[model samples]
Target: MSTDKKRFSADGPAPRQRFWKEAGVQETADGFTITLDGKPVRLPGGNPLCVTARPLAEALAAEWAAAGLDDPKGRFTPADLPLTRIAGTKIERVRPEREHIIATLADYGAHDLLCYRAETEGPLTVRQAEEWQPWLDWLNERHGITLRVTHGMMPIKQPEPALQRLRTLLATRNDADLAALGVAVPALGSLVLGLALADGAITPAQAVAAASVDERVQMERWGEDAAILDRIAAMNEDVTDAARFMELGRG
Candidate 1:
């Protein structure tokens, strides 16, 4: 995940003056780029913020265009450009450290959330099987890799062959996909759920629910906490944004 906390801050540096009148997309020899009143957009790394996918370019343009639409002062912040941020990370970070990123993300499979089950049998355990097992089964059936499930906090060592298979699969993804996975995997804390989200195998809501089964069960037993609810809401937004980023990049 990105360590640049400021970029994802909810109250990013006070909204700056909006200088551009409109946003547009222009096709270039390399790919497509977003333009602010005809001026090409540049990433923080000082390179043109170009995307090989036109759909992603157009989406970035739309985000720029809508930045201050709802604010009376016509000002905006980094939070207003989620797609652009992810795209920037794709170019500025993931590309250069592709192999390292692949390995880091694949490591999630070793201690994936779905692989850990509730210690005592009850609603949480039942819900775990109901919500999480299908995806584990999907992983085995689709990729021939079965992740061993354990009950409680004790970590179970996943099969080395399975981990290697996952790493190989992750190596096949492009930088853009890896960028999306970076967000979704950390947010969901489960490589299985993140891959499922990226692959269109599950919707963002489904991923969130499956990942939050423990929290949901706790909330049911002890009532909801406002803070936890807010966290879950933020998580859903993150996952949804990542999913959209992946979809646009594929186009």
Candidate 2:
């Protein structure tokens, strides 16, 4: 599929005025599709914006319907339709490049954030072990994927078998799931946590808390800055949205 749709493009244009009076979902042979006033919605790639799950389709319809409801001029950006963006990624990117995307995400396992710890003994170090180690252990116990943990910024090699196991596990996921991981893994910097979130092993709030251990400790030592807080808030939203996308896509 062509990946040149402009509605979701970051540099394409300003928010457009809402044109559709209503959005709806329809079940089709292809899957569940979102519709605007009974017409199907198309992706930036011009492919039908469809998903396998009715709930996800309905969610996409809701996003589209509510896109510019609060604006006086009824203007909204692609950001307003987060689920559509993810579903688009699944169709435009993951479906065409599943193995490549799987490999890319699996590589995050090789250097998962949970494997890196604070270099010295202190609150940061204590917090790292307290907040992160259990998840690493979960990777080992739950998935039989044992990763090597280390201190300091110097890179440490993880076991080849472990990395291969991650790849194998990721290979089993559908395109929709891979799309969600594409968002969650990078946002949390840990395939372990991403997998946990996707598998319902942890909540988005817990995932964010686990991922933000170092940042939280740092902010505690050195006063919290508005920018850092904003970044954390955005990460929470992204991770939460990704988790929600996965959950809704499953149904």
Candidate 3:
């Protein structure tokens, strides 16, 4: 991937100028659409921001409605509306540039978080192996890709064949699903966790928890602090939002 191709944002384009008296959802013959001041909402790409799932449409409408309350200036940021941000990216970025996204995701598998373990012999090592080994085994059985587990942070030379198989599996996802996977992959720092979520093998909450196993184990040993706990809570929300985004896209 080119350096420019690798530098993509999930937020996609900047937030549109808000100029609506009211925001709501409208059901159409095709599906559901969000409306601003009785007019249908349009994505940055100039296409109608419509979805087949009523829940997703409603969620998007609600995001717009909330923006009205929060910003009296009629200005909103992408950070304020997670669902709308994702929907916009699905249309503007992910759909148009999918191959690059696939390559970016496949790169994560080369040095997957699950394939690295602590060198020291202690509870943390045991915890990592116990939580990580099953998914490694699952990959081996399912795709004949056996990732080597290393005891240190040094780079591991993963087999090119295994990496190719992982990339092949990633290519099977549609744009919306791929967008969600892209978010989950970097957030969790585990390509396997991202794949598990995409494959419907694990819930978003499970993915978040699994990715933070080492941190949680350390928290357990040293007692939870307020700052770390708050950070974890925010991360959990982001991961769950990505998972929900994928589910809505499927609908």
Candidate 4:
């Protein structure tokens, strides 16, 4: 992975190869493209895979659906393909534009690490801090980096590693702790719960029962606010997702 340039180089005296030389990305008339982020490069004589934004992808799908552009082998073109979907939402297009979604939109860093707090899952799970121990140790060992930034500087609701740590924080807490994480505290329970449910999961109703807020509250807040839930959940992307984002998989 390109992000691993420094990572790999750190293992030995060998200087990290410049990421660009290794990237193998190329430029075309429209703009530069990476194999990972490239758009609509031609694949055969006169045939092209058009690339564009999600909005553009949807428009193409609508256009194709209307026209019924079936291929000679009965395949579909942009005009005929269904838009790729994520998070119960349909995307008109996929491919490189997802880069924008991940940065401006989805979870993890550009490299796709799960990006958790030093103590996400709130110090309870055996694996909370331990889960990220390798990453933290790696970053610390390599770069001396240790800032648990929860969200990106942008207003988009990115989950800082701090938030993952909060799960642990919450796990050990009583009502006072819940209150601390909510409205008056300005930590904003809506955002917190939304992230928790984003995986469309509950670790176990019984496990959360000791926390003592009615399950209805969780349902009410998120169920009533689907959009908020979507935004918040996306930011809390799992740790493994971080690797996928980088195309390096997990350690």
Task: Name the best candidate (by TM-score).
Answer: 2
TM-score of 1: 0.92
- Tens-digit lDDT track for model 3 on 124-227? 89989888888888778766787888998999999988889888988888777787777788888888888877778888888778778888998999998787
How much does candidate 3 score in TM-score? 0.83
For every model shown, the clashing-pair count is: 0, 1, 0, 21
Clash count for candidate 1 is: 0
List model 4 lDDT by residue over 1-251, tens digit each: 46334323445333211111121234445322223123332333333423223333333334333332222222323212222112112112223233332222222222222233223333333333343334444433443433333322223333456334434433443221222122211111232222232222222231122121222245554565665454344333322122121121001
lDDT of 1: 0.89
- Candidate 4, RMSD to the unseen true structure: 19.8
> Clashing pairs in model 2?
5-44
lDDT of each: 0.89, 0.89, 0.80, 0.29
Residue 156, candidate 1: Cα error in Å is: 1.9
Candidate 2 lDDT: 0.89
Clash pairs (backbone) in predicted model 3:
none
Top candidate, metric lDDT:
1
What's every prediction's RMSD, in angstroms? 4.0, 4.9, 6.7, 19.8
TM-scores of all predicted structures:
0.92, 0.94, 0.83, 0.22
Cα-based RMSD of candidate 2: 4.9
The count of backbone overlaps in candidate 3 is: 0
Where model 4 places Cα greater than 4 Å from the true spot, the runs are 1-123, 142-144, 149-251
